[model samples]
Target: MEQYDIAVIGAGPAGLFCAIHSIGPGIHVLLLEKNLQPGMKLRISGTGQCNITHDGDIRMFFPRYGAHGQFLRPALMSYTNQMLIRFFEERNLPMEITEGGKVFPVSHKAGDVCEVLIRECQHPGVDLRCGEPVHRVENTPLGFVLYTAGDTFSAKNLVIATGGASYPKTGSTGDGYRLAASLGHTITGIGPALTPLLIRNFPFADLAGMSFAGLPFSVWRENRKIFDGQGDILFTHTGLSGPGILDRSRDIRAGDEIQLSFAGPVQCDTFEREFQNIISRAPTRSIKTIIAGLGIPERLARQLPDLAGIPADSTGAHLTAAGRTILIGHLTACPLVVSSPGDLSVAMVTRGGVALGEVNVKTMESKLVPGLFFSGEVLDIDGDTGGFNLQAAFSTGFLAAQGISKRVGKRT
Candidate 1:
């Protein structure tokens, strides 16, 4: 078996960074990845723009990770989004900041980011292998042992950065969870998150292309309100999706009904004035038809008469004050009965992974499994889109690599 100073498994962001940080004279470092090439997921993130990190104060960044926010606070502050941007820029790969302070490559290519990392990990002290899935990990008296296809390797330190199970097409496929579980590490609950919601709302059908661009919506879980976000939302045949919808997806329960709030970015008083304006202009049209044209879709518009207990064909002149009042209520906060969550393959990230308590934040190392460090979505930490996920991978990977260096030294 080849004995190395450090063996980092899963050539994703965390593993690659660990290898890069471990590089120095006389160090024996090996990086193993199951995918045919490294950064497959990175290549597709941000639609290939590779939203690497968000430019913001470290304080606000913590809440974005939810409960795991605290664990990441120290490492996140240490590496920071500013530093990651510099790390790439120093490699001649400049980045650009966009809406929501999201940072991306200048060419909007995730491939460029991946290319730079691969190049950086190519020093003599570092060795990288892809298309290799780790079969098992054995914790030795000193260091650790890793078994992969056709070979077994030994090292004094190991870092696992296999990413999350979401986006299996990128080769995440839950392999990390399996490998970590085998090492006696507890795998936290995992579920598809940042995915679109499927709905049974008929109006959403007609409003399929209609988007409340950067508008806000409230997501309800049973009778309790769960999550609220302000951003673009699009009506689809399935349900609802877009930046805002994806943001609130994790808190959404199976039986929740997604509804747009009237008390949203557009104020209720303003909506009332706007609604009355339209109702007065087209008394010739059915009150139902008139309201449909007021930012509500035809499919959803068609259902107003039923909600108001007035016939769809009933004229505006025929509608009493009661019918008009009832009609407005339905349009203001239309309800969408949710169906199952979108498939995991299409999801952007996983909501849950390895619990935070089990991993050391300063080192990004797993206390339960010595030498087994984790980063990226494999840990029970996920953030909303707009460059949060990529940042976590970059920051945590850097921290984990730094930890491995201090523990194992720079050489074999």
Candidate 2:
């Protein structure tokens, strides 16, 4: 039986990097990947552009992960965004930051980023085995035994970076959760996070490509407004999508109300007065014509009268008091009842995973099982869109590598 210093499962950003960083003069690391090619998901991130990480001080990353942000503070601090930028840049992979503060390779290709990591893994003493799916993991006095389809391997330290359930086709079929659960780790409420929402009986199905930029949006649960933000929204054939809606999808549930204010800066109190002023100026114009002139998309503006329950051909001068209120309300808060979250198969990331309490934040190691570690989406930490999740994966993987090396170095 061959023994190694570290066995990393999954070849995603976390596991691959963990294996790369853990290599040393005496350290022998084995990387097992279920897929034929590594970084399957990374290749498709940011529509192939690969939003690598956000550019800023480490403090900006705290709130981006929601409640779990503080848990990620130590790992992120150990490997700050600046350090990550320098780490890749020093290796000849020049990166650029966009206006949104997202960092990407100058090549603008996620494949290039994966190529760099894969090329670096060719370093001596590191064994990367592809098309090997870890069927089971057994804990032993020696350390851990990983059973793959091909054969079995043993390692003194094991890192499970198998990722979450989202994008299962890419080999992130929530295997890590099952693997961790088998080893006595608590799996949190697992669901889709950065996924799109499906609206029930969506009204603007025909206006699929219409997008509203800087739209003020709100989510209400049982009449209680729970979330509020401003983002660009895109109308899909099924419902709504885009950065704004995608960001809030984690908080939304079936039967929740998603409101979009196409009226922009106009408030309800002022909307009626402002609308009336426009109507007074163009009393002879049809309601559709008047709305289309307000810079709203002509296709969506044409449907506004029907959405507000007003006569489509009614001119501004023929507007009734009740009709005016309905139109004003509809413009300010177009309500859409959510049917459910987008399918997990298509979700960009998963919401819940192994609970945070069971894992050591500083090292990305399992608190219950010694010598067992986890990183990336396999853990409960899921961040918002815009390169936060990738940054978390890289930072945690780096820390886990450091932790394993430090612990094993003392033993050697």
Candidate 3:
């Protein structure tokens, strides 16, 4: 058997970084990748711009990962975003932070970022084997043995960075989940996150290209409010998408009801008073024209009356008391029933993976299986869109490498 200090599966950002940091003059590292090329997903992140990480205070970054945010404290504190930025800058890879605080390569090419990682991982004593997939991993009494297509390899430590089940085309087909489960690790309920919602009987088919910035949205399940958020939302022929919906998709499930409020600056109560004043001032103006003054697009304003059971051509004075109440409700809460979540193949990230409780966030090692480590999307850590998930991947990978190095040194 080919013996090594550590064996890392998958060649995404996490695996590459782990191998680069774990291998040195006295250590031998093996990187096994199923795909023909490493960093396949990293090469296409952020639509090729590759949002590396968000440029912000480290204190504000952890909570974006939700409940598991606290779990990532040790790793994040060990390698802060500032350290990551400096690491890349020192390697001649300049980065720029957008107005929204997303950091991306100044070259505007995800391939460049992948190239740097690939080059660093190819250091002497690090064996990178592509087009090779490990079929099984066994924890023997002496160490761990990995069975691949052509041969078997053994290592004192193992790191699984197989990523999540999103974007299957990039080779992230949820293989790590099965591997961990086989080792008696608990796998959490997996679902799609950062994906669009498929609305049932969508009425805004004509408004497909229209988008609302800073749109206030809420989700209700069985008439109980579940989630509330605000972000940019885009209308699709089948449903809604954009930052607002994608960021909150994990909190939503099939058949949940969505409420979108287009009344940008007008409060429902204030609108009622202002609407009556408009009617008293201009009784002959069309109700459609009056509603258009509420700040929504004219086309959406024209359709508002239809939702309120009033004709589009009706004048302001034509609105009865009941019609006025209906209009106010419709304006405040436009409802859309969700049919389903976006397909996993299209989601930007996976919501769940190996149960967080089974892994030590400090070292990225398994609590049950000693010498077995995991990082990246294989764990039950998913963050909001805009460079958060990638940052977690790098930070966790760095911590896992540190853990593996210490363990291997002590064993030797």
- Number of the top candidate by TM-score? 3
Question: Please, what are the lDDT tens digits per residue for candidate 1 over residues 1-412?
Answer: 8889878878887678768877877788989998899989888888877888888786788888766688888778778888888999999999888866888889998889889999998898887988878888888796788888789999888777888889998888888788788878788778888999887644546557767766656667767777666788877777788878887787776778766753345655577677677667776787556756665556656666776688887877777776666665555555667776776888899888787888887998888876778877788888888888878887888898788777665333
The candidate 1 region of ten consecutive residues with least summed lDDT is 261-270
Off by over 4 Å in 3: 265-267
User: Candidate 2, residues 1-412: lDDT per residue as tens digits?
Assistant: 6688899998999998888889899889999999999999999999999998998788988998878899999999998888888988988999999998999999999999999899989988889999999999999998899999879999999999999999888888999999999999999988888888889999998888889889998899999999887888888899888988777677778899988888786679887888899999889899988887777877778798898889778899999989998887778888899999897897899988999999888888888998999989899988888899999999999999998987887897
Alpha carbon RMSD to native, model 2: 1.6
The segments of candidate 1 whose C-alpha lies over 4 angstroms from its true place after superposition are: 262-317, 409-412
Deviation (Å) of 193 in candidate 3: 0.5
Which 10 consecutive positions of candidate 2 have the poorest summed lDDT? 243-252
Task: Assess the local accuracy of residue 341 in candidate 3 as a C-alpha lDDT between 0 and 100.
Answer: 92
TM-score of structure candidate 3: 0.97
Q: Residue pairs in steric clash, candidate 2?
A: none
- Which has the better TM-score: candidate 1, or candidate 3? 3
Look at candidate 3 and give me any clashing residue pairs.
none
